[model samples]
Target: MLDLRSLRQNPQAAKALLKIKGYDFDTLRFEELETQRKSLQSLTEELRNERNVKSKSIGKAKAAGEDIAPLVAEVGDLGERLDAVESKFHRLQEEYQAFAQSVPNLPDASVPAGSDEADNVEVDRWGALPEFNFEPKDHVDLGAGGMLDFEAATKITGSRFVVMHGAVARLHRALIQFMLDTHTSKHDYEEVYVPYIVNADSLYGTGQLPKFAEDQFRIDSDADFYLAPTAEVPVTNIYRDEILEAGRLPIKHVCHTPCFRSEAGSYGRDTRGMIRQHQFEKVELVQLVEPGRSWDALEELTDHAREILRALELPFRTVVLCGGDLGFSAAKTYDLEVWLPGQNQYREISSCSNFLDFQARRMQARYRSPETGKPELLHTLNGSALAVGRTLVAIMENYQDGDGRVHVPDVLKPYMAGLDVLDLG
Candidate 1:
């Protein structure tokens, strides 16, 4: 949520910045609400003052042995007027809050301007695409030797689901373990375990509710729990409504979780395989840092995610998301796209973002400022160190042999029990 004071102080400036994000911001609605709020507040103050004066007059008149019926009646009328004005003021305040929450974060000035992914600027590329003796197969076709089972997944659940068996299943678990281990042991992030289901407040704290509710899978029971879309929701909410000491300026956490998404708006895209699963696993990294250092933290976090791709020896590139491509709570974002021989293209495997203070403000996650001795919002950042399922896809597609076997990446051999090649026996 944006600071209402900032919008009130200079709405034109705010609107201009917001325009970069492709918002057709409504200035007139905001101005009209502000005008009504100020008017009602002024009226409420005047009425309260009149009531106080009338009460004092009544006391004076009683002491002097004069009738005070007219004074009492005047005070009662003022009280009613004050109540009406206050009621209207509260309503307008709520409206303003809804308006602010509905608006997405302003894009950073450094972000490139564009309407969609086509406009995103690539930053760097790594590794080299694999050479194949025969036509390369997609993960679906490559995992067809009883290793990846989509038919069973569909019957047990529905479309956009898959069940991995044998070495492929082992590979899936290995990917999660490898990612968590690397992030915790080498990336300086604390490992954390969080609930897979979360309440609405937790979702709202992370800017997921009200705006993206349709994209979530909510439980029907009274708990009103929703399956987490990403570990970012629960992990980041750990500091919601908290005030941290200055010394703990930066907190880093890495978590692995099963993410569930409705994929509500997407249809007929990437439906052939696990590329757009309703359920997927991810290793998520989150950081909360002091305001001034968040931009630097963004770079470090992006590099940490890139390290995983490098470790897997996957051909990939990093791109800065344009204004239209930015996430709801992110001021800026970098998407890591890994080369997929099957698709013959690069697909997103991770997204690292600097939300600045956008999410902190929503979460009420703050730290006491040493300079001002007051609580100030902290900056929050999160990224998929790598999406486990997609990494699995990349490995199978990139490491396939002409004999229809997949060789495990060197880094994952130990996790795969030292069996280098996944040959269907």
Candidate 2:
């Protein structure tokens, strides 16, 4: 959630910044609501003060040996008025909160001005795109012979799903392990195991609720549980409604979990393979740091994600997302697009974002500032160290030989128990 004080103090500046992200700040509506809220608040306070004054007068009348009936009746009336105004004030506050929650975070000043991914700026590229003498096939075609079974998955669950068998399945698992190990050991992130299911509050804390409800796989239970959309959600929410000491300023966690998405908006895109799936594993990296160091933390975190791609020997490029391409909660974002021989283009393998205090404010996650001796919101950052399925897809497409065998990346060989090649023969 945005700081209401800042928005109230400078709605015009906020409106201009939000416009870059494709959000039109409803200043008129906000003003109307704010006006009413202020009026109701003022009335509520006045009534409470009047009631307190009148109630005290009733005691004075009683002590003076005079009939206190009139004063008692006046106090009762004031109490009734105060109750009505307070109730309205409470309701207006809720309305204001709803409006506030719908607004997206303002993009950072450093973020480039653009409307979409086409305008995103590429900052760096790594490795060489694999060259294949034979015509490279997409993951769907490469994993055809019972290795990547979409048909069986369709029969069991539906579209946008896949079941990997034999070596392909092992490769998928190995990618997860490799990513988790890399992030935990080399990147200094603590490994965490979080629930695959979460509540509505958890979703809201991560800026996925209220706006992207349709994109979630919500459970039918009365408890309002939803399938984890990404490990980022559960992992970052570990400090929801918490405060930490200055010494614990930077908290980093790496989590591996199965992510579920309804893909409600992305109906037809990437429907052919594991590129888009209802169920896919991911190795997610999350960090909580003091406010001043967040920008540096973002660079460090993006490098940590890039390390995984580097270790796997995958060619990839890093692009800074433009203002309009930024995620709902992120002030800035860097998307890592890995090269795929089959697709003949780079596809996004991970997104590293600095949410600043946007998510921390929403989660009420804070830390005491050593300098001020006061609690302040922490800056939260998270990234897909690598999306496991996409990494698997990249490996298969890049490592395929003329004979149709998939050579495992050197980094994952130990995780695969010395298995160097994947042959469905």
TM-scores for candidates 1 onward, in order: 0.93, 0.96
lDDT value, residue 402 of candidate 2: 64
CA error at residue 110 for candidate 1, angstroms: 0.9
Query: Global lDDT for candidate 1?
Result: 0.91
* Root-mean-square deviation per candidate: 2.8, 1.9
Q: For candidate 1, lDDT tens digit of each residue in 1-425?
A: 88878878888887887777888779899899778878877887887788778788899999999988877875665677778888888888888778889988878999999878988999999998999879998988887887888999989999989998888889989999999999888988999999999999999988998899999999999888999999999999999999999898689999999999999989878888889999999999999999999999999999999999999999999999988888878899999999999999999999999998989999999999999999999999999989999999999999989788989999999898878999853
Model 1 vs. true fold: TM:
0.93
Worst 10 residues of 2 by lDDT: 73-82
Total clashes for model 2: 0
Candidate 1, run of 10 with poorest lDDT:
73-82
